[model samples]
Target chain A: MSGQTLYDKIWQSHLVSGDDEAALIYIDRHIIHEVTSAQAFEGIELAGRSIWRSDSILATPDHQVPTTEREKGKAGFVDKLALLQVTTLDDNCDKNNIVQFKLNDQRQGIVHVVGPEQGASLPGMTIVCGDSHSSTHGAFAALAQGIGTSEVEHVLASQCLQQQKCKNLRVLVNGCLPLGITAKDLILYIIGKLGTAGGTGYAIEYAGEAIENLSMEGRLTVCNMTIEAGARSGLIAYDQVTENYLHGRPYAPKGAMWDSAIQYWRTLVSDADAVFDKELIIDAKDILPQVTWGTKPDQVVAVTSQVPEISSAKDAVQQADWQKALSYMSLNSGTAISSLSLDQVFIGSCTNGRIEDIREVAKVVKGKKVASTIKRAMVVPGSGLVKQQAEAEGLDKIIMAAGLEWRFAGCSMCNAMNPDSLASGERCASTSNRNFEGRQGQGGRTHLVSPAMAAAAAIAGHFVDIRQVELAQLEGIH
Target chain B: MAAFVAHQGWVAPMDRSNVDTDAMMPKQYLKCIFKSGYGDWAFDDWRYLDAGDVDVDVSTRRKNPDFELNKTIYQGASILLSRENFGCGSSREHAVWGIRDMGFKVVIATSFADIFYNNCFNNGILALTLKPEQIERLFELSGDKAMSLTVNLQEKRVTLANGEFYSFELEENRRFKMLNGLDNVATTLLKKQAIQDFEKQHKQTHPYYFTPLR
Candidate 1:
């Protein structure tokens, strides 16, 4: 038999029983949030079943939690529908004996962001969540994926999930990244090349020189968008970078246990001769800051390129899709992306709302002012800890000084679960994932870009190549 | 849970490709804890000229006369004839809920996004895949007319109005679950003993992974 890929090693280790076609995989961590999980808890409760291992599950109310008016407590929710979902989750967590990070708690944040920061996600373990973005946890080399509500109920009742084994696909991004390119740009570029369905039916492992060089937070950004590429899970082999990031975190192992865990993690890599079902090689030097021109993540192009014309599409379907996307975005064909004006700027989501992302944006717009023509601009941290760390580093001050609204952490404006959404016919340069039509709000258009690029757009009142923007001199800043 | 052994409904053609869950049920509507009532807001942005709200009566709302679903011929259609990548983006089961509640029991497409397809099966909605050519043919056949199609899960076949039939495949376990109106938890319970044994061994070997309730 051939040597096994890292995905195979993790899958086999987590396999409880049955053949490769379908088996019960033990879940180490189960993360739940307000959006997709209410019905799951209700399902089990109605069936007279209880959470099998409440301790293994982490609950938080993100998605619909307002990013403003924190002092108002639960009553702070302006929408009745938002209040109901958030309160439902609270009731479920309390009744099930699961510890939850309440809205007022310091730990409360986006499920995907808080999981790793709290050390609940670790290498060689299996993780599942009701949210698709749970693939974010796979950055730690864990076997992670998103599940439907039915599967959520299954895991809550048994702490295990029945799943079919997926084929392995390895994406090796080699060479050094050029300046101004972020992991967000890299992922968007890859998804653009490999259509949204490219990673379907497979578990993709990102490897090579470029992936290895990424910081842990950058790795999280890459893995977080794996779902948009249509991958059930995306993984990076555990190494020093992974281990160092996990050390001493809240729920990470300690002392002898930590040593033992590291010892086991060392074995999590693929064997030298391991074979993948498919392998794709991407040159990092060829990549640039990317922006999605269409509703889907895969419909992306480098920031410097113009909107592609319908006649240039390879097929009839593509031509029609291009026309539709252009009509919805209200952009002219062949016009440079940099020429597109923006009405709003959003620099936060599970995709790019980590401390590093905020720091990068702050570095870009420190002494600058947001364009007077830009209607709205906001920077939301990923988690409460990230928010606090940004404040401690004075990143918030720099962002606020640039005239961008500094908001609390959540999945703000990413999918517009809160009040931070764009109005009808508005166009925005966002740091969030998924620029699907009306994703930010009804009839609102979105362009996906990096935090730095988004910040640059906020200042210019239009999309601009971040590399061309001169950083404000720190010495001149008050 | 309800069995979906066979469904016969008039077809409604959604000519667009990559009809994502967000478009099916916008993010704003996901706020409600209730699974029902999403039907009224399904495709709300495109369904109505005016912004839609739950409390507003859909009948009185300014329906988009140009939208496919509002067309006179497709008024009560139950099977959605769509293009490739139907139900892409997001793992929200609420999207499936809205589709089902909107009277669509079947979705015929060339392919489907992974999570959305699974959610369809769980919700008793048959998401059948056909070859691209066959899907194109179906779309051609659906043009300018409300065509009645039959999806028989028992036989794993989709019969066209002209007496043509195409076979589809589903996993045996999934098929069993659908036929018996069983949810995943109910089926997994049968393997409870094996799961319990595994957990016992796992907790001991990986004690740090488990955080028992205090």
Candidate 2:
């Protein structure tokens, strides 16, 4: 028998029965958000079926809730449809007796952030969410996959998903991480090497010394973008970092149970002789802080590099993609990336909206003023708790002092389903995932960056090498 | 769910790779809470000249003349022949909903993102891939003109109007679901005993999963 990878071990433990053709897998957690969920709830209601394992479900609204005026709950919405969707989730969760962090609840936040914070997603378990970023919890060595709304309903009705096995693809990012480089840059670099579909039909395990050295929050940020590589899911083995993060989280096991859980989690690492279907080793030294200059996440360039020229593309087909991106983003080919002026700066999303990300932003712009060329910049925390912690540490004050709007929690401008959206043709430096066309709002160009990069962009009004800025600030203080 | 035994329709070539769900049904239209109304918003950003939201009626939006879907030749096309990573970002079934609502029963791509591919069969749409050369050939055949293709799920072949055909492989489980219109929910319900058995054993083995919140 071959030694199983972390994913295989979790899969075996969750296998209800059957083969890879149609294996019945027991679902340990289901995280639900509003936009993808309303139809699922409707399916459950129309079918006249109740939740099979309601205890396994965690419900929250992220996509459509207004990040501002959230204290008023459904009444906070200036958009009636948005209000209806947010309240509908509340009614469904209440009616089903499922635990939900309601809009006004302090515990509420992005489903991905809340999952790990509350420890609802634990090691050696199978986690599914309707939103794609659910891979964030895989930082805990869980087999986490993002599901569509239909699968959401199926999980609600059965607590079991009929799944086929995914092949394993291990990505080893070794070597020391350069200063001022973040997990966002690391993952973006990996995605650049592996095109949007490079990890298709496989589950990716992120390993190597660099991955093993990341903080739980940093690891979560990396895993959250797994789907962008078209991977089924992403996983990282449980280690002391995982234990420290989950130790006393609300839903984590307690007392003797904690010891028991740790024993099992200690087994989550891949055995020495274990083999993967495919493997790619990335040296972290080759990575630089990334800024996506195009419509796709894979069309990324280093902050100091020029916007990629169409001729630089590998083939005519690639040039075609580059042409579309260049046209849509209204950028001239071969222009310096740092020369592009920004219309706005947004620092939030499941990927970069964590508390540590807020701290990074505070460090970058703690006393700096927003550049006169920048029209607007804002910071929306991941969860109400994140917002509260930033306020406690006075990070929010520093960010607000730098002239960025400090907003409440929700997906906010990430998807811009609510009132927080970019105007037509507005360019932005954003800490959110996905640089897809019209992702923030129609015709709103977005350059994906790290929190510090976005904060620096807010002050500089253009992309700059974050390392140089940090070094300058350090020297000035000295 | 409807059985997808065979589908024949005008093939509309999307002509781009990495077309995401967000672009298919932009976030503005995602709050509608129902699946049926997303057709007009399938490629909302590109299909229209004016921006749309759930508040503004799509009927009032000006159609972009340059867009493929708005072009007269591809009207009522039900098969989408496109390129690599056809559905890449987000787990929004609304993308599949928008495509289905737009009347596309089959999407031929070089590859598809996993979640979007799964969402397709669940909603009675067939998302399949062909060899690179085959996709290239299809694009060449259909360039700047509306072409018709017959997607036969039963035989796993896509037949062109010129009688050329490409055979693709699909997992038997997914193929069974699409051909029979058996939604996994109804099918999984039949395995209630197995789920219960698994739960019983799972609780005994992994006691932490069932413990009360502290």
Candidate 3:
């Protein structure tokens, strides 16, 4: 018999008895957010069903909460959405007895951030949420992914999810990533190499030397973008680095239980000879600071490269898409992306708004001032804890001194759920994921880049080669 | 409730492709978790300013507004006539809520993002998929001063008041639910007795395991 990969073992163990067409998998943890859960809760209420396991479910209001404090129901410019979101979640969670980390609660932030902070996320657990970014939790060696509202309703009522088994794809990245390149850049490069839907119908297992060397934060960044590549979930084999991060966390096991937990987590790695349905090997050395020049994540090029001409594109569909994207973005075919001007800059979201991401941008923008031409810049942290920590480290001061708006932690312009957004025709260099037309706001153009690259653009008033800024910053530091 | 057929009134043409969830309903208006009243905020930023003042004239807003939907051709459109692959990106239900709230009864396009299309149907929004040529005709008629189209769900046809007609398809289950405003869970519960029987039988084969409290 072949050695089972962690994906196979965990999946097989969670399978509950069900029809041949679908397996009713026992979900160990359920994460809910205000956006998708409201309707599901209503469905549950109308169907006369209560939550099956309130203790196993966790909720947080992130997407719609304002990053700045406005008096409750005061009707500030951004207060309408904020008040409605916070109150709606507050009322719903109270009625259903589902645990919620509200705005006032210290634990409140993004659902993904709160899950790990509150200890609801653990190894060998199946986590489901309405938000696609729920894949971020796979960093803990858990099987986590987003589901639709109907699936959310089913899970809330039964604590079981019906799903089909997925094939395993192993992505191996070898060699050391050069200094200044981050997991964000690596993932963007990988996604660019493999079209957005390349990993459809697969659960990805990230391996190889580069992955093994990543910190837990770096691993989380990689797993968080798995969905962008159309993978159901992305995971790194658990190791001491994983255990170290989980230790002393709110929900982590303590004392003897901790020892036992470590032992079990050791068993989560794939065996040396474990087979996979597909394997992709990436050369880390070749990856440079990356950015999205078009609407989709796959429509990317190196920061130094010009936007490719549609005529040269091999695929007819790709050519058409390139033409459409170029027209919408108001860019010429052979224009150098590095020369493009930016109207705004944002460096925050569940994808790259962690403490490490903040520190990286701070290091680059420490003494730099926002360019006079750049009208607006903001850095919203991912979580309350991240915000507090950044403040303590004076990272917030560095950002503010640079003339960027440093606000409270929330999703912010990542989706424009909050007050922060781009005006129409305004272009932004943002660290958020999707760059589709008006993803930041209607007619707002978003060029997705790494946090460091965003900081560089904010300083230069345009997309400059991050390499140039990094070299200058290093010289200053020395 | 009476059965209503989809009428093809004047189809408002939005030639822009890859319209995303945020454009459909900007996130700023997505605060209400109950999935109610969000329809008004669907394009809140594009429609009005903070003080409820019209930022741009309706024609100018549609013609040269900063929002993709405002670009001249797609203004006050009850039926969003678009190219292929509309509603791509995030699986936000706000997109559906916004479209339904905007008084758009039907979205006629060549294709839609998988999640958004499913969401549109679930939230009682009609998403009609048609061939490219048929959509082009609707776009052509949108420019006519005398052109008014109606989407009659009962007829399952989009018709111009002048008798230009186009056929669309909908699954029977979806059609029944939309006509009755029934949610999937509500539909499933109608078969509660069968579900309960299946649950009881399964319980016998798979006894629940209890973990003792420490």
lDDT of 1 by residue, B61-115 (tens): 8989999998999989999989878887899988998998999989999888888
Q: Residue-wise lDDT of candidate 3 within A396-459, one digit each (tens)?
A: 8888988999877678898885678888788899998888766787678889898999999999
Query: True-contact fraction for model 2?
Result: 0.82
Off by over 4 Å in 2: A471-478, B212-214
Best by lDDT: 2
Rank the models by DockQ, top first. Answer: 2, 1, 3
Minimal lDDT window, size 10, model 2 chain A = A469-478
Q: Considering DockQ, which of the candidate structures 2 and 3 is the better prediction for this target?
A: 2
Task: Write model 2 residue lDDT over A1-478, tens digit each, in one string.
Answer: 6778888888888898889777999999888888888899899989998888788888878887788776676778888887788888888888888889888889899998888999899999899999888888899999998999999999999998989888989999988799999999999999899988999988999999899889999999999999888896899998999999998989999999999889989999988777899998999999998999999999999998999879989888889999999999999988999999999999989999998888888889977899999998999999999999888878877888889999998898898888888888999999888999999888899999999899999999898889988622321222
TM-score between candidate 3 and the true structure? 0.79
Candidate 1 regions exceeding 4 Å error are A472-478
Q: What is the C-alpha RMSD of each candidate to the true structure, in Å?
A: 1.8, 2.0, 6.1
* Per-residue lDDT over B60-94 for candidate 3, one digit per residue giving the tens place of the 0 to 100 score: 33222455454444545667777766775676777
**All DockQ scores:** 0.66, 0.77, 0.19
Report the lDDT of model 3 for residue A56.
Answer: 69
Retained true contacts (fraction), each candidate:
0.60, 0.82, 0.24
